[model samples]
Target: MPNIQVSALAPSTQVIRFNRPHARNALSLALLQETATALHAAQNDDSVRVVVLTGDDKAFCAGADIKEMSNTGIPMWGQSERLLAWKTLENFPKPLIAAVEGYALGGGCEMTLLCDIVIAGQNARFGLPEVKIGAFPGDGGTQRLPRAIGKSRAMWMIMTGSLIDGPKACDWGLATEITPAGGALARACEIAQTIGDMSPIAVRMIKEEVLMTYTKSLDESLSLERKLLLWQTHDHNEGIAAFLEKRRPVFSGR
Candidate 1:
């Protein structure tokens, strides 16, 4: 079977599942390549409006496959293909949500940071335990974790190599919500459906603008938002008219 499985949850929502359950869905090079391929395919498929990334009940992902790394003697971060795969996720224009259960450590935690939203199960455990193994998170964990959960908490996780439960993750702002064990994927899919029902143009633009806020100055961010607001497409007009007419608006993604 494929290490990664891509399936349609709804007409507009696509799910990418990490299928290496025995290894706790570790991020091997093959899995990364497959994930990138699935993501690119979803990006180009007009029928797919939102993407949900998840793994099986046992684990979201344990992190990079240490055995593979030791055997190959290769660094994932320095590898061009792996870096490109991550970049593909970073540049994806559509909405991306992470459905996290069990372990999300090191590279696994970094993967969640790439998503626009994170829904974690009650059994989830998040950490950057690379330090314990004499390594550190090289896959956006150092940068994104600080931005998401603030400097102190991110520093604590990185330095201590300690794990936090799902509730604490939600409190720390790492997770948007916490569900019962094994419910994260369902919750994420539900949210994805709602997002898919909205204007695709607006959704994409909103995601772009939100991510842009991380690096842009306040004035620059506002300027960009204003520009997007003015570039309102047919969907925007339809939305306004639909509100006025008290009817559902059909968006063509124009």
Candidate 2:
């Protein structure tokens, strides 16, 4: 069976599942490539408005494949297919949600940072344990984790290789929501569907604007928002008319 499985959950929502349960869904080169292919396909499909990433209830992902790493070393950090795959995921324009359960460690934890929203199960555990093995998280963990949580918390996790459970993760700002055991995927899909029902153009723009806040100066961000506000689109007109008509807006993503 394929290590990764992509399935359509709704007209506008897609779910990508990591299928390597035996290894706790440890990331392999082939799996990363397949995931990138799936993400590219979803991004190109106009019908797909949101993507949900998840694994089995036992584990979201255990991180990079240790056995493979022992022989191949860390191929993802350099100019390799895995690096390209990681880039593809990071650059995906549409909304990406991570439904996490069990363990999200090292690269697995890093992957969640790439998503726009993270919904973790009560049993979920997150950490960057690479330091314990004489390695470090090379997949944007050092950078993104600090941005997600505070600097000190991220420092502790990276330096000590300790883990935090779902509630703690949510408190630390690493996770957006915490659900009951086995409910993360369902809650994530619900959120995806709600977002899908809105104006696709607005959704995309909002995501862009929020991400821009990380690097853009305040003046630059305001200028960009002003430009977006002035830009005429069918969705904007539809939204205004719907409010006046007391009805739902039908957006064509224009």
Candidate 3:
């Protein structure tokens, strides 16, 4: 069987599941490669408006495949195929939602950080345990975690290698919502469908502007938003017309 599973929740919402349940869906180089390919395919598919990334009910992901790393070692920074694959995942333009069931540790947690929305099960466990293994999160954990949950909390989690459960994750801002132990995927799909129903141009613009606000100066971000105003898009006019007509708007990607 393939390391990952891709299915459609709806015509516009895609579901990508990590399938390696035996190893708790630990990310191997092969799995990472497969993920990049899947994400790239989704990005280029005009029909795919949203993606919900998930794993089995037992585990979201345990982290990098430790067994593989034991034999081949962790991929080093810069100019590595592994890094390139990660960049592909990071650069996905559409909304990426994470439906986390169980453990989301180390690289797994970092994956959640990459997502625009994270729906975690009540029992889901999140951590960066590399410090316990005499290493640190080699992925974007150091950078993204702090940005997601704030600096001191990230520092405590990383330095102590402690795990935070679902409720804590939500309170810490690491998770957008908390669901029943096995219900994260379903909830995520619902959210994805809601996003899918909106105008694609507006959704993309909102996502881009929000992400940029975190990295760019306030003036630059505001200027960019002004330049990419939704009023300039056909979908915006359609939305207004639909509202006045008391009917649904049919938004074209244009």
**Candidate 3, lDDT over the whole model:** 0.90
Model 1 whole-model lDDT (C-alpha atoms): 0.93
Candidate 2 TM-score versus the reference: 0.97
Cα RMSDs of all predictions? 1.2, 1.3, 1.6
Overlapping backbone residue pairs in candidate 1 total 0
Please count the clashing residue pairs in each candidate, in the order shown.
Answer: 0, 0, 0
lDDT of 2 by residue, 1-254 (tens): 89998998777999999999999999988888899999999988999999999999989999998777644553546647778999999999999999999999988999999999999999999999999988899899999999999899999999999999999999999999999999999999999999999998899999999999888999999999999989899999999999999999898999
Candidate 1's TM-score reads 0.97
For 1-254, candidate 1 gives per-residue lDDT tens digits of 89998999777999999999999999998999999999999989989999999998879999999877744666767889899999998899999999999999889999999999999999999999999989889999989999999999999999999999999999999999999999999999999999999999889888889988888998999998988778958999999999999999999899
In model 3, the runs with Cα more than 4 Å from the true position are 70-79
Q: For each candidate, what TM-score against the reference?
A: 0.97, 0.97, 0.95
Off by over 4 Å in 1: 70-74
